[model samples]
Target: MSDNLAINGGPKAITLKQEEALRWPILTEEDEQAVLSVMRRNETSLSEEPMKLEKEFAEYLGADYALAEINGTAALYAALFVLGIGPGDEVISPSYTYWASAMPAATLGAKVIFCEVYPDSLDLDVEDFKKKITPKTKAVIPVHLWGVPCEMDEIINIARNNNIAVIEDACHAHGAEYKGRKTGTLGDFGIFSFQASKNLPGGEGGMLITNNRDHLYKATTLGHYRRAAGLPEEYSKYQHTCLGFKHRMSPLHAAITRVQLKTLDEKNSIRKNNIEKLLKAIEELPGFHIYWPPPHINRVYYENDVVYRGEETGIPIERLIETLKAEGAIVRRDRYPLLHQQPYFIERGSNPEDLPVTREINEHVMALPTFPGDDGRLVEQYIGAFIKAARTF
Candidate 1:
């Protein structure tokens, strides 16, 4: 079992990540004890554990409030809904993000305004982001893409100047920091995912953090009824007020998250060390460029795609993907395309022109892997495989 390739061929484990997931199955005695603590106490539905988690999270994040939710996507959706983003509103987001980022805006009947990212860092283009802002643009979501920090100070300053709210997609960033502030605390509202492979792996759970009372008040209204424990009594009498949602976290997930949160910094440090090892080894190879690495700003390892700069550059992405997969490294191209380009959105009839940078990056980029069960070895194999794969084209 240990010698097995780190990725699974299972239908559900679409990426090599699944095989990797299997290798590091969560059977930690401490984690099991946490779950047993929940079960032995026989209350598995957001008890004091969740409150403890939230309070600890707030402390960890340096935020005034931390609200646990069902999952990351719901956390984003709830944040937008609570903040009152609705039809005809527009949210500015970098094109290079998970579909979850843009989909929330569109699902709320809001228009998704896409902006380009800096080519070198693959971060949002601050000037381009400001230019794309308009009266209709109600929010700016700077996705700390692949756990790399976007210039959030610049982003926060820009959003404040525009009076627009910022919601950080901190799903890939657990212990990450920028200028002494943690990722979730830097934005108006920060959403984190506890999907299984994350540094804070809870299988499937999410959290939202904020300093604003209004947003927290509204979020609680929509995220749960006050009876859901940990809430002040004043909020208790008001049940189902103003169209609330049933998006509270499960006790099972929360229990696991509580255990994981204790180890977040440790897990993150390991990923960081492995990434440094991978980058140092690969940078010396011809046609390789490492992503962000700097002091204080750290990344939780995630997907990355090798960009080959050479003759026959015009080759379409499908052909490129085929060759790489044949060589046995699971690779996915730039995670998200523009929402306007999505068929459902296009058919529903709203495609704004002039997303040239979004269009370009979506087509050309591919994400590489850097997850647990990982040392730099897979990445090393990938470098050789990528070079060989490119020659085939």
Candidate 2:
């Protein structure tokens, strides 16, 4: 192994010529045409584009109903409101995820109970979740972190026994499946984000999907008055009968999303193959390990998480990340803090000790890029950079 580090003027690992940095909204001419078609018609809003996107999105997921929101946060809020989760209620969610999962609960005046996550799956630990449930527990949001599906069967069973609503926070798991079923459909309601960084990028938008007609009706009326269900006969046409928020999706976003949805499967396949090849190359190296999903999961790779067994390598994770970046691999630390310890939660009297595993996982986990159609040569360069950096660690 080379004694000199790249930071000290040694040769960098990534030497390939790649066109663009790895990220989302991997658009093509089709994506352009899709949005242009909507724009050219001057039907940018209050048009069929958003509704058409909803229909196509629902069909794509094999879901009974789908509705759009301005963003994932709005979708979550809408889900909670439609399900009657509010003040005095408690919502459980894993701590090792984006704060969006818990923010809705907090904003609803519901107590947010942050739970531990299984390190391998990065999902809520069933045992920990069970311990958090109380009569006040009205809902559980199991986040499918990094496109990995949670143990849905166990979670569903627990929620059913406790009579708690299960909402899958599938913002990162589009095109993913669990136990031969799509992830978003397994729960009472599922929320997905098509943020600029997501697998199926729609710039900034969200989708809520469910199988329950009642949920659909409530959800439609809750924030989407235009799509409200069961209007009274006495009500005039286009009259809003129910109270709702302005969380509707714009036609421009929906039009772009429709085209992006069509290419999701193919994009996911590319990401999966790229990740598999990269993992195979370096997973066996000392102190380097990758979590393999269970057979029942067909996960899409929105982000790549590499766990460094620092005790085994005798190197700090920060040092490793610095070395990888010096070697030309675009890498970074986890962006979100453990939910229980976040200032936003702590100021509201949250208990930091509620999630021990989450704290440990966040310490060693490193984020890697997993955008679709990543250059094969660049991927090889990344593997080389990772392996070389790991050796130094």
Candidate 3:
């Protein structure tokens, strides 16, 4: 019986080629031409492209203003800076998300209070967030982990009542909607990353969006000094000696991003359909679970992660991963390390043991390729591999 499993020399279940199916960014001739146009125009250092991209992005999200930055981290830092998050201030963020979501506050001399995430949705647990806030809480960053929108309505209401600013980290959630409203438009400030791996890739870029004019001007002054000249009279004087950080997105990146943005919804739909198909196939598998969002939230897929109940199946996660790999399925453990457990936070007195749910999720969740292109055959094979591994264990 052991020999029947792929890890023991049996035939691999997944035999289809997956390179094209899982390829990201999905660059085409249009993207290439856009980049070449920037190069031919010799606008690598500065150009109107970034401004154009910002306008288009803001329009796409129905936002009042948008500022393009060098990268997502810079955009986040600018967001914190504009909010006046400085010494003695406290910023609340989820422990299970990417470091940029919370670490930027620390850079601004503010204390980062790491909160817990819901084990089911992998989003900020509003109850945990509410408990973490205090008089010093100047801002709360609700990260839409892996493109799943957080409980925005509740989070926004709680923040409003307490007068805490909401910075929506919508880096992984481009084109995702919560209650029919886009992710970036739902907060006091919204931030997005256009890194190569993002749903809307720009190689390496980010954008900050907001409806507040002051916030927009301040964020622009933080990184985009050149654009400060166009700001209202109160800020235009600082154009020459702006806040000293140059976080402008490259014209080439903006060019690529603009083309990518044009097809974001269509591409997102493809990914959504593909992932749903896989979920449907594996829903009944023992000891496996996928978090399907409520009807009102339209989530996109940045990475496909399925929770494995190792204790229930009596199968070690390591063993399950090994078996799946042998069956030709590209599988791995969860990527993000709990921010509270990292050395920087540890030195700052963050206790890892406090976030049991995040630790459990980090331990049991396994990632699979979010096939960006149509690959029904490969997905079917992956489903078979999952089923076979579960039955074997």
Candidate 4:
């Protein structure tokens, strides 16, 4: 089929990005300079500029090693394949995420099990996750949705007891921490998305991280690696260590991502501040809720992609989204339908009701803009417009 969906790239009514303060809503001068600098010198590929970025990213995340991949989807598939998940194996992940998160596992012949989110926090539902684990379960891919770290301590404990490997989908979370440990480091392995919309925007790139040497070796090997220094000559005698894919990130994307990583802390701080202002502005108004961060939670973010928190406002979310869009607010419904509900998964026999909480949130939730470079006044404008729409309709 054509990858021509307007959402992907077609004359998008409201471009994916907004411009303010003389900068694209999500990028900075440093981001541009870094990318151009790499191009000017003609350095490219994982062996050159991408390698430097990978090293810096690893150091910043305090992980033992980090490998850059073509995108988050590839990062996830590489991580799961190295863990030996396939055919009969099952991998659990929240249903409330982009399909890219689970499709990787599914493509590998592993059953992608959908888990429900904790109702109020919208983080992973730990209790439900425990009940779903079985002997066939090989891994758990917990997503720190929208920058909110799930209950990692509890989830990790469950994973440990079940002997199932954990690979966090930290795509939405960059600087997010849980109980002092960073999200990516909390699991046996983790992956982050550096897509244009992520906190660490790099256009299209991802990082797979781990402290385990064995996992590092396996991940790199399956991620299109030829023989390297660490392995003995005997290892290369085989065609390939395991199933592999061409998943390496280009040096250009990595160069830009490296610059974004350097400023991640500074940018994230502004995101948190912006979320708070948005929360305070819309909290008391009827037909709206911000799903504010919990006391123990410190990070929250926006998508620059607007979502109306009032799907149940008696105004169908679709209608409200249209009203907001008409006013220039890039609002839309939360697209995380239960993985089991998708035609692709169902045709393969997955069930839509498999994850109750996830399906519920998927039907009700929506995201709103939070990119740091956007004008704060726009958030207010949308909030006010939403309030008017809520009452008028």
Query: What lDDT would each prediction earn against the true structure?
Result: 0.72, 0.83, 0.90, 0.73
- lDDT assessment of candidate 3: 0.90
For each predicted model, how many residue pairs clash, with residues at least 3 apart or on different chains?
8, 0, 0, 3
Off by over 4 Å in 1: 1-27, 228-237, 240-242, 293-296, 310-335, 348-353, 375-393
Index of the highest-lDDT prediction: 3
Clashing pairs in 3: none
Model 2 C-alpha lDDT per residue in residues 1-393, reported as the tens digit of each score: 454669788888887655564646678788789888888998887778777878988888889988888889989988898788888999998878888899988998999988888877788899999999999999999999999999999999999999999999999999899998888889999899989888888988999998887776676676767666445433223237545577888888888888888888998888888888888887877776788987998888888887877798888778878888888777888646777888888998888876667887787787887746675667888888877776665
Write one digit per residue (lDDT tens) for candidate 1, span 1-393: 122222223121122443652244244888888888899888787477767778888898889988888888989998899778989898988766788877888899888887888765666889999999999989988887777777888898999999999999988778888877888888889999888876688878899898987678667777687543345555545564634678778777788888888877876665566556656655564444566556767656554444433333554566666665755766667546566667766765546455666665555566655545565555556655555544434
Model 4's lDDT to the true fold? 0.73
Residue 125 lDDT (model 4): 86
lDDT of 1: 0.72
Better of 2 and 3 by lDDT: 3
RMSD (Cα, Å) of candidate 2? 2.1
Model 1 per-residue lDDT at 271: 59
Cα RMSD, each candidate: 5.5, 2.1, 1.5, 6.6
Instruction: Give the Cα-based TM-score of candidate 1 against the true structure.
Output: 0.82
Candidates, ranked, TM-score: 3, 2, 4, 1
TM-score of each model, in listed order: 0.82, 0.94, 0.98, 0.86
